[model samples]
Target: MKTLPSQLTPFVRSDAVGALLAETLGHPDAEFTLSALGRLTGVSGPVVHREVTRLVDAAVLQDRMEGRNRLVRANPEHPLYAPMREIIAATYGPVPVLRAAFDGVDGAEHVYIYGSWAARRGGEAGPFPNDVDVLVVGDVPRRTLSAIAGEASDQLAVPVNITRASREDWDAAEPPPFLRTVRSRPFVDVMTGAVHGG
Candidate 1:
């Protein structure tokens, strides 16, 4: 998995840990078992278990036994809960939200966030990106992509622009100029697992 930017490294252990924190701590209502979190963040179960143990020891997370499984959630009562949530929100919020937004969208093979926001996340110095640019590669319908983007925009408090391309277009041996440019820039894959170094 790709490592988070340097600025986020002190607070975030790894991309998987950040994703787990973002999903659980960032959203009070969200809860997950170790396996579920692994599935969501694309982290292995052993890794998720280790991270969860650390967070639980630090009082950042609370885990309870439920039948054959352990259900984990953020500890809202922790003194640092609010601030920690804010940090996770600022750094990793878009990912889970985007994942949720496009969860069931048919024919979406890969989803990536490109352009300014992605660049900023990749550690380039600049003013914060105002809007998010999304590239959806698959055979999804434009209207469906638009609707998903609209919902994500409202949820993230940022404008979202979506661009679609077919699998063939995205994987063409000699891709078009736009595809080449997109592939050349920094990007964050929000679906089908993360790819490091854009």
Candidate 2:
């Protein structure tokens, strides 16, 4: 897996820094080990450790010894913590935010993000995406998805558009044209954090 695009964090040296910040700052109350953060952000272990150490050295993150494991968490007391957290929430916050929104929603089997936002996260160069496009594969009702999208939009500060497709249509020998296009470009699995296509 690749890191997020540099545009996501203008001051950071690598996109991995932004991603690690998203995990830590985005969930301020939670503590994570280096390897756990790596898994969640799709970053490799060495990079996760290096970036985390840098943050800790800069006082952006706080870490403590926990037996043989090192536990890391956001340092809310840092002067830049609030503003940096807000920036991360608006940019990299969609994955966890939307995943939480759709949790246990009946009939929503698979959720994906496509279009410009996904492309940018996949490291493609482009203008900042103004909205998020979601594809839900299952039998969920439109009204339900619309409501979810609305709330997600409010949380993310970006418009969220959700389109649902039946399992039959999604898995068809000849998928719908829309599915074909979505599968031909960069899209992300909301649950697994996997990137597919370009």
RMSDs, each prediction? Answer: 3.1, 2.0
Tens digits of per-residue lDDT for model 1 on 49-159?
888999999999999998989999999999989888887776667877887788888898988888877776565656767788888898888889888888888877888
Model 2 lDDT, full chain set: 0.86
Model 1 weakest lDDT span, ten residues long:
1-10
Compared with the true structure, what per-residue lDDT tens digits does model 2 show for residues 1-198?
445546655666666777788789989999999988877777789888888999999999999999999999999999999899998888778877888899999999999999998887777878888999999999898999989999999999999999999899888989989999998898978875556888
Candidate 1, position 37, lDDT? 82
TM-score, per-candidate, Cα-based:
0.78, 0.89
Off by over 4 Å in 2: 1-5
The number of the candidate with the highest TM-score is 2
Q: Report the Cα lDDT for residue 60, model 2.
A: 95
